[model samples]
Every structure is written in C-alpha cells, then in structure tokens.
Target: MIETYVDERDYKLLERDRYTFFVLKRIMGGECKLLLSDHERLILCFTGHPFPVWIWTADDAAEEEMEKAYQLAKENKLLTGEYHFNIKYSLAEYFIRRAAEEGLELKIITNMFAYDCLEPVRPDTESDGGIHCCEMKDLEELVDFMDRFHKELSIDQKDISGYREDAEEFIRSGNMYLWKDEQGHNVASCKYAPDGDMASINLVFTRPEFRRRHYAENLVYQVTMKAKEAGYVPMLYTDADYVASNACYEKIGYVLRGKLCTIG
Candidate 1:
C-alpha cells in the first residue's frame, strides 16, 4: 500500500493539525492517491490488504469533485470513505449524506467531553469494568483485544497489527490506561501524548464485545483523572464524522475547539 500511496506533502502541510490531533494517521501500508478537482482537494488513501479506506477533504468541495474521486476509487475497488468533522465546529450533514449515497462509509471522532467541558468528570451509571495502568507485559492481551476491536470495526487485521506496534511504543511513552473486566480481560484503553502544557489523548479503543458498555467512558474517566492530576489540560481530536464517538466525547465532557478537514 505504501508503495502506491501518493506522496502529498502539500496536503500534509495543510492538514497537519489533524495529525497533531490524532484524527488522521499517515497511510503506512499500500499506496495513496490525491485528486485535485477544480477548487477542492480530494485524497484517496487505500490499502489493498483489506484495511479501512479513508477519504479526506480540506473543506467542502464542489459535489462533482467528490463524486469524481468516489467514482475513481469505485473503479479501483475501494469502498470505504471517512469524513471527519466536529459537531460544534463542522458543516452540517448534507455532505455526509451525499457520501453515503455514493456508498462511502463515514466515521467521525470527536472530543470526549463537549457540553459542559470541565475537569474531574461526573461518573455515569457505567459497566462493571476497571481501568488499570498497562505495562509492556500486557502486550499479548492488548494485541488480542485490538484484533477483536478491528474485526468489529471492520478494519483489516493487518492494518491493526501495523498500528498496534506503533501504539505499543506510543503507550510506553506515557501513562497508559488498560480497562479490564471482572475476569481481568482488557476491554478498553487510552494513551496520553504529553507535550508542553497539554497532553492529547490518542487511540481510545474498546473491544467489540464491550461497545456501549461504558468501558470507554470509565477508561476515559481514568485517563482524564490522571491527566488532570498531572496538571495538564486533557484534549482529543475527532474527525467529526463519527457522530457516535462525538456523542461519547460530549457525554464524557470533552469540549470541541474547532473542526479539522484532514487531507490525507
């Protein structure tokens, strides 16, 4: 995939904040192609290894532009397209619906808490799961849980492993939380990327069997707790399309600063 991934330095330069926010990661497998249609920039990032396909736009483009890119990918056998934007800061759903009509799957990520954004969250009537600080010893469980998570999310196993390796290294660089169940099986987790005065939360994932179980809530609870205790503002970036994740972040208390249109 990497071999075919079209190198787009200008796109990265424009959407760097998305990478800074964890809303977008560079395509590491297969190849990427960038399409320029009149005024809008369309990026087609596809890995033939059954990985999730991603479509990004700098902003709202002419409908024909997106359609053209969509048609090209459809011709090339790519089916997934993700649109990221924040509810509080993004353009409404008209474009997202259009993407759907074209058969592109959309996923959005947002801040965990958005409504009354405050530190020290209020607990919800959550599941019976606990969050633990994970060490390298838990690598096997982490990989297993991630495998199931990808399956549930319809992501390719190969893509998850490529990411899991980097995730382990990133988690090791900070305080990592591993949410586990009564039997001590890890269910959810988050990694805090510490920078100067802020620690951006990245890679918040829960196992498929644990979805809607509030494992993500509780795990985020611990993640925010530790971040607050360390005296840094905890923050996260969402692609802004996955409304469910955005809702989860809002329920958790993450405030939306703005929307980012990742051109990856």
Candidate 2:
C-alpha cells in the first residue's frame, strides 16, 4: 500500500537519492506532498501550485508496489492533466514502458548536468566583449532576446508584456548578465537562480548576428563562475537533441548527472 505521509525511513530513502531528487530537497516541507509505498521503496513528490510530479523507485522496489503507488496517485487526482516525470535516467525506461502499457505516451525531454570548479574547464574563448549585469536600461533589448529565445526553442510564445515583465524581474533579481562588445553592444545573455544549494543556469542566448564570436560561451562561463562563487552547485538542463548546446556545456566542465522524462 502507498501512504501519503513520509516517515523517518522515507527521509532516509530520499537522502539516498539526493542527486536525483535535488529539486525535491529545495521544495520539501512546503508546497510539496509526499507519497510513499509501504517499504518506502517507491515514492512520489507532487507539488500543488507548480504542478510537477516527481517519482522515485528503489532498485529493490517490487514492480507490483510501483504500479500500486502510481494507481493510488492517479486516484488522488495527482496525475491529472499534464504530468512530467522527473526521475533518474536509470528509471526512465521503466516509466516509459509503464506509460505505454497504460496507453499514456511518455518521452525523454532533457538531460540534467552539474558542474563544479574542480573539473578542468576548457579555456574561455578569447573575446573582446565583457560581461555586465543587466540593468533597467537594457530592458528593451532583453525583451527582444526573450522573444527570440522562445521562438528558437519552439516553446509557446508569451505576449510582449509577459516578456517585458520577465526582463524586468531578471534585472531586479540582479542575477542576469549580458556580454557587451567593446563597442557596448549586447551580444549575449545568461542568468541563474539559486535553489537550495544548487544554482540553475538558464536563459543562455546570443543574438543571431553574434553566433560565432564565442560570446555565448564567454557569458555562460562568467555567469556559472558567479554561481559557484556564491556557494551554489552549478547545474542546467539541456535538450538531448540539442547537440551543440550539450557540447558547449561539456567544454565548460559540466558532466551529465541525470535525465528527466515527460509523461502525458
């Protein structure tokens, strides 16, 4: 049987899977609800507001128990609408197969990678541009970048005001940075947000005209360095199909740590 509340044993299980459950560590005891199988071998952490579902299954967890836990979660309406399964790469096949058995299509979205200054990162490309924290004066340009970013990714585009608001928020957070050429033109941008002991570096983009100048690599390197200097482990998610981006991150010292699959 699956239980809704987690006990001491479950906490220990969570600790054993800390890397796979990093996001859970940052949100537990708040908006998240824990669901555990009797042996605490299979678990789910579902957050209400954000509506993300995370699943974990121990190597020894019985197949029957895993199915039971998933069914119970569905009965509780936890799997309604769209639910992406954020789980370890080792468990991806099991979930994907199970989703197929249930007539639900699931797919691997991206691989998660982490980095520490310990790895010998490739030397930053020599570029004439310098990194600078974004300010309100850069809002208009930031909005344009945001638009191109979503379009390039094929993600649903947000309205102009939504992009403007995102730009303003990034600027106010003081974590967004732009790579400005010697002539003071913004060539690339990158930003990070701290979550518990991890800082997720995202929104790394360079304008089309500046693609080959190594501006993006330089900007990401600078932003990642800032994240590390602030005492947070640096990490990011990248689409597995995006070979160039993955190659870029690897050159900067990031190592593939895990993967997430989306279930619908």
Candidate 3:
C-alpha cells in the first residue's frame, strides 16, 4: 500500500538506514516533503525548485511496490514539468522503463557514487593556517570561483547576481569555507549541506592553476573534519566517471557506500 505522510515525526523511522539518511535528514530539516510505501520500504522525498525527487527503496522492495510509488507521484503531479528524479542504480532501469511506458520522458541520465565517512577526519598538517571560513568580504571572489567551477563541469551557469545572493546566504549560514595560499590568494573552496546528523560536502572546487597541489583535497578534508567535529556524519556524492575527484574522496577516508542515478 502507498500513503502520504506530512508529520515531521515520521522521519524517526528512517534513522537506522544509513543509505537513506541524507534524504531523511533533509525531510526532518524541513527541506523537503515525504511519501512512503509500507511505512518506509519505499521512500520518496521531494525538494522543490531545481532539486530532484529522491527515491530510495529497500533491497527487498517488490517490483509492484516500486510501480505503485511511481504511480502515486504521477497522480499527484509530482513527476510533471522539468523536475528530476534520483534513485538507486538497482531501480533506475526499471523506473525509467516504466516511466517511458507511461509517456513520461526522462532524457538525461547521470551515474553517481555516494561516499560516507564515520571516523574522525585528520586535516592536512600543511593546510592548517591556510584554510578558514568565508567572510562577507570574500563574496565576489567566491562567486568568481563558483562560476569557473560550474563552467569546468559543463553545468549550466547561474546568473552572477543570483549567484551572489545565494553565496551571501551560504556565508551568513556559516556553511562555506575556502583555502588560501601564503599570499592570501584563494585557491580552493567547499561547503556543507547539513540535514540532522548527516551533512553532505558539496561545491568542492579549485582554480585550474592549483589543480595538482592538493588544495581541493585539503579543503574537503577541512570541511569533513568540521562536520565530524560538530557531531554530524559526513558524506558526499560525486560523478562516478570523474576519476580525479573519486580518487580524492577515497584518499580523504570516505568509503564507497552505494551508486545513484539521476534522470531529468
């Protein structure tokens, strides 16, 4: 059976499932809404505006239950428009095939790897004095870094004005940090997206001139350490095909946990 749940308390039932913890944490943080099948076996979380509907199903979830979950989303208009869907690889093929049969097109598919780290992180000894939280005065430089970061990845570029606004909010929330060299030139940056006891390290980037210097790695290590120190389990998602980044996360002590696919 499928049902919709609105109460924040419903998230407590998901605490034991680490694979779904980030989505559950987002729901608990009021960042999204939740729908469940059989109380938790099949979970669908919707974060409106640019974010996708994250679907997580138990390994033993029957095919019928998965189909029902998709049907519920369609009936509620959740699958319409330009919204995207993110699900495990084990279910992505089935979900995509089924959606096509229903005349819903999911054109772009990207494979990703999820990583999690539980042990305390050790910061690079040489990076200690160069890393620090971003301040309001650094907004313009941060925006420049973000633009270059997006361009390098071929991701759509955000309007500079809008980007500045978001960066300001991120700085005010104490979620952004940057790495600077001895001359005070910013070389790399990263940020945290926290939900409950789980926080995802995101926006990791380094200037092309600083690519091989381990600046990006150091920034991620610092952010991960901060998240762990604050009592949150640190995790991150990266493109599976991005070898350098995948290797960097592994070197930073994150272990591969699962694979996810995004369709839009």
Candidate 4:
C-alpha cells in the first residue's frame, strides 16, 4: 500500500517503527512522506508546498521523460530526488550518470536486492580467531574513535570525516560493533544501518597495525549476531573488489547476490 505524508519528520517517524521495504522523501527538513513498493502513496502529506521540483521517486525504465522532468525541475530550483532500484534494474550507474548530466548530488546504496543474504548464527568455532563486539552508545567516543582510525590509516585531510549525524543516529537507532585487539582497542568496526529488519554495515575500517588479522571476520560475526538478536538480517555493501571485506563476507556466509557498479 503506497501512501504519502506531508511532514518530513512524520515520514521518518517510521524509522523506528514499521518493517516494510520502503522509501522516504524529506525535502530540506520541511515536507516528508512515505512511499510504498509500487509508487503508492504509503503516506504522503505535503507541507502545502510544491514550488520546488519535488521528485519523491522516479521510474528508471522511463529514463527519457524522467531526465527531461529532472532537467526542468532543476532549472526551476525544484529538484530533490529519491530513487529506489533493486538488482533487477539496479540504477546505481544510471543515477550516477543522471546526477552528472543533471547537476545533482547523488548517494547510492546497494543491498541484498537480489538474494536472501544470510550469515552463520555464529562464527566457526574451528576458526583460529574469536569474536568481539562493543557498542559505542556514546557519540563523543565514536568521533574520537574515528579520529584515531583516520590517523592510523594515514587518511589525511582535516575536513575528511564520517557523518556526525549518521554516527549519532546509528548509536541511538542502530548497533555499533567492533572487533577487539588484545589491548581491547577496536581493530575493525561496523555500524549497522538504522533500519529494523535489515542491516547495512558501514565504516568498516582496520588500523594499519591490525590489517589482515582476520579482524573483519571477528567484527562481522559479532555485528551479525547483534542483528540476529534484533530479529533483523545482517548484511553489508562495500566496494566489490575490497578483497578483505569481500572475503570476510564469504567467510561469514554471504553469497554474491549481485554486483553494484557506481560511476561517482
């Protein structure tokens, strides 16, 4: 059932509620609404405003018209877009291309749109390493942790940082787990997505001093367990060729459901 709600805050209110696969449209913290699977108005309420080219969602197969609409909307200073594409028509590349041609900033997220990705209830006991899981529950500590991680990885740029709101949001609404070293510092960290029934692992980072120690395996196993306990399936999306992460996902029992290619 597709419904649309007018208030942005109201739309995201379900972030902690419902479990349906859905999409949300929040225009600069003003109007918000929920969208059902087939372009239904799950709950759409307009803040009584549509002066902007409010693109709640679009169909990729209707590319030509969609692009034209996007161009018109953009030129008129009314272009905000939300897209939902599965493996069948995964528009990661399409969105990247359109964003460039239309001068829009786009973020692409890929998930288990092709397969029912599952992880072992726990790690293989026969495996040499063990598991470690710790939740940051604290935002300050998370930022500090990221700072140290960036330094350890030699990731320069003073302005280069992860999303502050995302970290805080995850700490409150999601689960944050880390693989620990003997000294108890995190060797790797994976913050699950805020969604209830699905897990999207992000910020998977390993320190230079701790690379290739099966830290990913430990961290992934720990995070997956948390998801299981929460009654949600644990999953992740990463650079397809991130050898360590890809191997870790396989080691923990995730199948290659499909491939995601992004232009930007």
Candidate 5:
C-alpha cells in the first residue's frame, strides 16, 4: 500500500536515509510532498516543479510494491506531468519500462553521481584570497553567470530579474559566494542550501575564460567547509560523465554515496 505525507514532522522518519535527504529537506521546507510505500521503504517526492520526481526505494523492494507505488502516483495524476524523474538508476530503468508499458514517454536520461562529506573540506590556499560572499553590488554579474550556467546545462533559463531576485535572496542569506580576480571580476561562484543537519552544495559555475583554473573547485571547497563549520553535512550531485567536476569534488574529500538518474 502507498501512503502520502505532507506534514513536516514526518521528515524525521527519513533522517537516517541520506538517499532521501534532499527530498525530505524540501518537504520539510514545504517545497514538496512525500509519497511512501511499505512504511517508507519506497519514497517519492513531488515538487510540482520542472525539476524531477525524486524517489528512493530499498534494494529489496518487491516488484509488486514498485508497481503499486507507480499506480498510486498515476492515480494521483503525478505520473501525467512533464517533469523528469530523479531516482536510483535501477529504479529509473524500472520506471522507464513501466512508463513504456503505460504508453508514456520520457524525453531524456542522464546518469549522475551523488557525493557527501562529513569531514572538513580543504580549500586550496592559493585560491583562497579571491573567495568571498556575494554582495548586492555583485548581483548583475551573478545573474549573468547563473544564466550562462543554466544554459550550459540545457536547463531552462530564467530572466535576469528572476536570477537577480534569487541572487539577492542568496546574498541576503549569506549562502552565495563568488571567486573574484584581483581586478574584482567574478570568475566563479557556488552556494549551499542548508536543511537541518544536511546541506546541498549547488550552482557551482565558472566563466569560460576562467575554465581549468580551479576557481570553481576552490569556491565549492570553501562553501563545503563553511557548511561543516555550521554543523551541516555537505552533499552535492554531479553529472557522472563530467570527469573534471567529479575529480574536483573528490579532491576536496567528497565521497561517492551512490548513483542517481534523471529521466525527462
């Protein structure tokens, strides 16, 4: 049987499951709803956004349970949306097969790597001087970088005003940071979204002219370190095929926790 939970208190039930950490955090923040099966062994999060349907299931979940979960989602109209699915690779495949049988199609599939660090992240001393929190004065540059970042990833780009508002919120919250050149040109940026004891690092970006300079890596390292100092476990997700990003995160002490897949 499948059950739905919208209360924030139920998030504690998922505390020990890192695979569900991001979704649980979002749910606690009122950004999504949770659907569970078999007493939370099967988890699904629906955000009603363009991102994806985030899900996790126990390795031994019975095939019938998986079917029931999908059926539940379908009945709730969650399976009729255009959003993608972010889930364990095996489960992604299972869902794909099931969707095919239902005559539904997914547009694209990508493999991803999830990483987490419990220890202090070490930043490169050489790249430390230019790293600092973003300020309102840096809003325009930050928006430009964000737009470029989303474009590069093939994600739909938000307007400058939207990016500006987002950057402003991040700046006001003191969670956004940028690496600047000696001349004060922003070269790289990164941010962390904190949720209880866990924080997810995201929006790491470097301009084309600044590529291969270790700026993004150093910025991420700084953010991760800050998160650790604040008593939050730092985690991040990267494209499995992106070798440089994977290497950079590993160099900063992020360990691969598992594989994730997105089907759009």
Candidate 6:
C-alpha cells in the first residue's frame, strides 16, 4: 500500500541501495510533496516545481510490488494528463507495456550516465572563456538560458513561469555556473543538484552560436571537477535521441549507467 512517510525506517530501506536510488536522497531531505513506497518501490512527487514524478523500484522487487507501484501512480493522476514520469530503467519496459495495455502513451526515453572515472578526462579543447559561479546579476540571463534550453529540446514548459524562482534558488545555493566568452558573454551554463554521494549535473546548455566549439564539454568537465572536489560523484540523464549531447558526456568519462523512461 502507498503512504506518505511512515518514519526514519523508510529512509533506512533507501540507504540500502544508496547509489542506485540516488535521487531519493534529495526527496528525503528536501521538500517532497508526496512520497509513496511499499519498501521496495518508491514514488516522489514535487510540490512547487514542474519536475516529473520520479519512480524507482528495487532490483529485487517482486511483480506484486511493481503492480502496486503502478496502481499507486495511476491513482495519483501520474499516468494521465500532461504529467511526466521519470521511471527507473529496470522498470521502463514494464511501465511502457502497462501504459500501452491500459491505453496510455509514454513517448520519450532517456539514458542516465554516471561518471565512472576518479577524475575527469579533461578535454584538450581550449576556450577563450572561463567558468564562474552564477551571481545575482546573472538571474535574468540565466532564466532566459533556461527557457531556451527547454524549448530547444521540445520539452514541456507549461510551468516555465516559475523559472525565476528556480534560477534564484540555483544561484543562491551556489550550484549554478556559467561560461563566459572572451568578450564576457554567457556562452554556456550548467548546474548540479547533489543527492547524497551523487551530484546530478543538469540544465546544461550552450548557445547555438557556441556549438561545435567544445564549450559544452569543457563547461561540463569543469562542473564535474567541481563536484569531484566536493567529494561527490557526478551523474546526469540525457535524451536517448540526442546524439551530440550523449557523445559530449561520453567524452567527459561519463559512461552509460542505465536509463529513465520519460512519459507525459
């Protein structure tokens, strides 16, 4: 059965698979709107963000557990409407098949990558720009970049009106960075969200005019290095169909770990 949170015991179960169920750490620590779990499968939904509902199942989860998980999701309106789902790779096929069987459609699938190396394989590529932490003055520009980042990928932006707050939080946390060109133009930007020992590098985007110049790879490498310095392993998820972005992360020593099925 699904429940909000029983007690610290719930977190203990998650700690058993810390690395595999990385994002749960954030939900457990942050403002998780609703957390439904049966000790083997978990679902985390946000309260004030447009992010998707994240679902995870233990590797040894039983079929019954999976069914209960799916039922919980459906009952919460997570399976229909404009809501998106970020489902664990191991359960992707099950959910996809189930959705289809139930007359639901899940369109996109993404690959999750984790840095496998002890250190970044620094690209030899040089840039006339330097990376720096985002500042208060950069808020407006960062919001614009965030907009372009989502739009370029055809991502849903119905909740974009809330990006200003998101940008502020990112900057205030000192987790967001931007690469400024020789003339001091913001050419690329990236941010990391730490969850336990893993730091998720996301919202990475380089302007179109800066493409093919290795700006993205270089910027991401710097971010990875920062995360490494802070004693956290770097990880990210990229669109499976985005060849160039996937290749860029691969170049930075990020290997394919698993995937997430994104359904909207």
- RMSD per model, one decimal: 7.2, 3.8, 3.2, 7.9, 2.8, 2.6
Q: On a 0 to 1 TM-score scale, where does candidate 5 land against the true structure?
A: 0.86
Query: Can you give the TM-score per candidate against the true fold?
Result: 0.54, 0.75, 0.82, 0.56, 0.86, 0.86
Q: Which stretches of candidate 3 lie over 4 Å from their true place?
A: 1-4, 31-38, 78-81, 102-108, 120-129, 150-158
lDDT score at residue 50, model 1, on the 0-100 scale = 45
lDDT of each: 0.56, 0.72, 0.75, 0.48, 0.74, 0.74
Whole-structure CA lDDT of model 3: 0.75
lDDT of 2 at 6: 65
Q: Which ten residues in a row have the lowest lDDT in candidate 5?
A: 5-14
Whichever of 1 and 5 has more lDDT, that candidate is 5
Residues 137-240, candidate 2: write the lDDT tens digits: 99999999889988886543678998999799999999999999999999898998787677878888898998888888878888888888888888776776
lDDT of 1 at 169: 78
- Candidate 4: 10-residue stretch with minimal lDDT: 44-53
lDDT of 5 at 196: 70
Clashes of each: 23, 0, 0, 20, 1, 0
* Candidate 4 residue-wise lDDT, 60-140, digit = tens: 345654444334334533335533232212334445567777677755433222122465634454223444434454566
Error of 5 at 129 (Å): 5.0
Winner by TM-score between candidate 6 and candidate 1: 6
- Candidate 1, 1-264: lDDT as tens digits: 112333456345334334332322334222444322222254445444543344554555565655565565556644444323322213224335655776754444333231223565556756685778877888767666666655654534555667579558755875877888888878887877655456677567887676788888778867887887888777776545678877777777787765543221
Runs of candidate 5 exceeding 4 Å displacement: 1-4, 7-10, 33-39, 78-81, 120-125
RMSD of 2: 3.8
